[model samples]
Target: MAPSSPHRGVQHTLSSRGLAKLALRFFSSLRPTDCPLNCLGKARLDFNLLPLEGELHCLELFQWSLLYQGSKLVATQQSSQTGLQFLHCVMELQKKGIKFINREVESFKNIHLKDGTLEIPRLVILDTAMSLFLNLGAFEQCHFNCGNDTTTYLFFMDDLIDYAEQMRHLHNCGIMRHGLESDAEVADFFNQICKEMVLVSSRSYLSYLSKDVNTYFGNKWNGWIAILELKYFSNPWSIISLIAAFILHLLTLIQTLYGVFGYYRPSS
Candidate 1:
C-alpha cells in the first residue's frame, strides 16, 4: 500500500530488491518533472520518460496498489445460473418465513448515502498472498476500524471454514461463491489470511452466528435427519431408489409369511 511509509532502516531491508536507491531517486525526480506550471495548471508528468530503474519503482507502487485494494471477490464457478439460482434460493427462503436482517454497526468507513444504503469505498484487485498480507497488516495498523466491516467478515469466514469440504458445503448451500481453482485454494486463502490478521479481541460480531450454527447441528435429531436425507434421498434418482427398496422389502416379507404359513404350498 504506500510502500510501508519508508520505515526506518527500510533501505537496508530493501537493498536485496535493488529498489532502495531507485525509489529515492524516483521521488527526487518527481519534484522537477511532476510539479510544473502549464497553461491551465500544473502539467501532468509523463511517467514514460523515466529511467528503467525509476520505472521499476513505479511497478513496485502498482503492486502495492493491488495488495491495498479491497478483498478479492471469489467469483462463482458456475457463472451462468449464478443470479437466477441466488434469486430462487432467496425466494424459497422468503416463502419459508426466513428474513434477512442487517445490523447497523458504528462503522468508520461505511458511507451513508442519500439512498440510505451503506457503501464502502473499496478497490478490488488480485495480487500475491505475501503482498496481500503485508498490505493488509499495514492497513490494520493505520485504520482504527481495520478496513471496516471486511475485517469482521474475514474473521467469521476464518472460524467457520477450515477444510476444502467445508468450503464446498458452503458453496453447495449457496452461502459462498467459490472462485478459486479448487476448494483447497479457498481453504488455503482463509487459513493464510487468518494468520496474517491482527485481531482486536477474541469476541467478534459473528460470534453469535457461529454459536447458533454449531448449536443447530449439535442437536442429535437435527443432525441425524439431515444426514439421512442427504445420504439417501438427496436427488430424484436416489428417492426413486429408496422407494424401490421399500417396495421390494414389503414384497419379500409377504412371501416369507406365505411360505411360513403354507399359504403358497399345495394351493392353501
Candidate 2:
C-alpha cells in the first residue's frame, strides 16, 4: 500500500511508449521502391515485417532468424517433382556413405568416389545470405571446380522451393527440416537466394547425381516400381492394406483352383 507500486506502473508505461515509438519509426522508413540490383528490374522491396537497415537487408534478417532459432526451413507440405528428385539424389548419395569434408584449403577437385565412398568439399551457409553467395562466387574464382556442387545445390533448392506449397511437399516427405515460422518464409529465403546466386549451368558434384536421377526416372518400369513402393510403403496403413490385398488374392486363387479340380474329379 506504499503508493500502490507507482514505480512499476511508470516502468511499464515507459516500456510501452518506447516499443510504440520504435514500431512507428521502423514502419515509416520502409519504401516500396524498385530494387537496385539491375537484373531484377520490376521487383519491389516489401518490408511488411522487417525494418530497413543499411547493408542488413530482409534476406539477412530472415536467415539470421532461421539460424538463431535453431530452425530448419522445412517444407510444411510435399514439394514438387524436381524438389523431390533433388532431395532424393542427396539422400541417395548420403546412403552411399559419401563423406562431405569442410576444409579450409582451396581445392578444385569437386567430386571423387573411391572404394564405394564419395567425397566433396562443403560450403557454409550462414546467417548472411548475400555474404554466403559472395563467398561461393569467390570459391568459384579460386577453386578449379568453379561453384559446382555448392552453387548447383543452391540453385537446385531454389528452383525446387518457389512457393510455400512446394516447401510443404518436401517437408511432408521428411526431406525438409522445419525451422522457419511459416512456409512463406522458406519460400522467400530461396526466392531471394536465387536472385543473389549469379552462377548457374556448370559441372559440380550434383551433376553426376542429376544424371543418375534422370536416368532412374527415364526407365519407365523402374519409375513405376519406385512410385508403387513409395505409395505402398510411405505409411503403415497403406502397407497393411497392401499386404491384406495380397493375402486375399492368394486365398481367392487357391479356392478357385480347388473348386475347379473338385468339379472335374474323375468318377471312381
Give the number of the best model, judged by TM-score.
2
Taking all chains together, each candidate's TM-score versus the true structure is: 0.40, 0.44
Tell me the alpha-carbon RMSD of every candidate.
Answer: 17.4, 17.3
10 residues in a row with least lDDT, candidate 1: 79-88
Indicate the TM-score of model 1.
0.40
lDDT of each: 0.41, 0.45
Off by over 4 Å in 2: 1-127, 138-149, 165-181
Score residue 15 of candidate 2 by CA lDDT.
Answer: 62
Clashing pairs in 1: none
Model 1, 1-59: lDDT tens digits are 55555564456444524553355345432221122223222111122122233223343
Please write out the lDDT profile of model 2 over residues 1-268, one tens digit for every residue: 5566888866765565455435434532221111111222112112222232223333333222212211112211111123223433334333333323322222212334343333433322224444555555445445542223445556666754667776665555444544447877766776776675554443443455455544554556654555676679779999999999999999999999999988899557
Candidate 2, residue 8: the lDDT equals: 82
